[model samples]
Target: MYWSVVFPGMTEGQAKWLLPRAEEGLPGLLGSIVDPNYFISLHVDRHSAETMKEALLLLESSDSSTESKGIARGLLEAVDDWLDAGGKYLEE
Candidate 1:
């Protein structure tokens, strides 16, 4: 399942790299629980969150266009805030 949200002007290559990394890194930012069905609900750690944040910052800074940079910055901020808030899970 794809957990990453695609921002405007994102390239296919960018999504390919970002989505899985985001999914993998999110568990560290958000605490996880194992369900009765043995499904892992979350994963991620401080290091992963920091790494993802750094990557997003790099993407934001490397963008040639102002719009792309803004989008990247937004994504970075969202991730940062989510981490700071301890993240959230989708309710069924």
Candidate 2:
């Protein structure tokens, strides 16, 4: 419950693992979301495109770790691909 307070679905171990990185900066926080499936679903389904863009900006501006930046990049690409393929359906 302690870690899940911030990210609801994450296990205690996951939260524990993320805490240190999150304390570092925005990249740390974003990078801490290690699961690609969860990351894509959470951002693509829940966040606006503008917000996702901002996160991308944060990653670019900060000293993001290679692994963390990689994960974020993957999420961005997945979201973009989904939007491209599902654009018509979104309006309905």
Candidate 3:
């Protein structure tokens, strides 16, 4: 079965891989978001400040690859800025 939430450019195997990770909360969910717009929406609308904070900390300390961490870092920074700007649209 496919996930109800479709991620851009994601394959069936990737979706399967993402499912369990997503259940682990923001740390798991952040990496699979290929679209910046979706990340912004999730950060602004779904997650709270505290949740994002914890995710940031956890991801920073995680053993994931440098590339993945780098991507997540940038996304988190965008989230921070978006939150600071009162959920304004982030420029691509």
Candidate 4:
């Protein structure tokens, strides 16, 4: 899920596809992944990357009312700060 959202050059479909591989190859993919707070990006295909990027661009270009924009900006700022502080969004 982090790979899907935050991984560079990887698309959502690629991220989803690599879920099993990441789970299976952690020991051998990049030396080792025993740390409880570690994550690795597995792989990304070109087609999937382009599609997701296009959707992301569309989303970025969309406009909204002032209230909606304010809320969105606040959420993005919170997410950015959380990321800067090395935090993960946990699904409760």
lDDT of 1 by residue, 3-92 (tens): 533265655576566666776876754322223355423345556667778988888768469888887788688678867876544332
Clash totals, every prediction? 5, 0, 0, 0
List ranges where model 2 is wrong by over 4 Å.
Answer: 1-47, 88-92
Q: lDDT of all predictions, in order shown?
A: 0.63, 0.60, 0.62, 0.49
Model 3 TM-score, all chains together: 0.40
Candidates in order, TM-scores: namely 0.38, 0.40, 0.40, 0.30
Please provide, for model 2 over 1-92, each residue's C-alpha lDDT reduced to its tens digit, 9 standing for 90 to 100.
01222466776587667777666754534334455555543423424754675687689567989888887888677657655655333346
- Model 1 regions lying over 4 Å from their true place: 1-48, 87-92
lDDT of 4 by residue, 37-88 (tens): 3654434343444444455444456775666656555645544454455543
Q: Which numbered prediction scores highest in TM-score against the true structure?
A: 3
**lDDT-better candidate, 2 vs 4:** 2
Model 1: pairs clashing at backbone N, Cα or C within 3 Å: 27-43, 27-44, 28-43, 28-44, 28-45
Cα error, residue 64 of model 4, in Å, equals 1.3
RMSD in Å for all candidates: 15.4, 13.2, 13.8, 13.8
Which RMSD does model 1 reach against the true structure? 15.4
Q: Per-residue lDDT for 19 in model 2?
A: 75
Task: Give the candidates in order of TM-score, highest first.
Answer: 3, 2, 1, 4
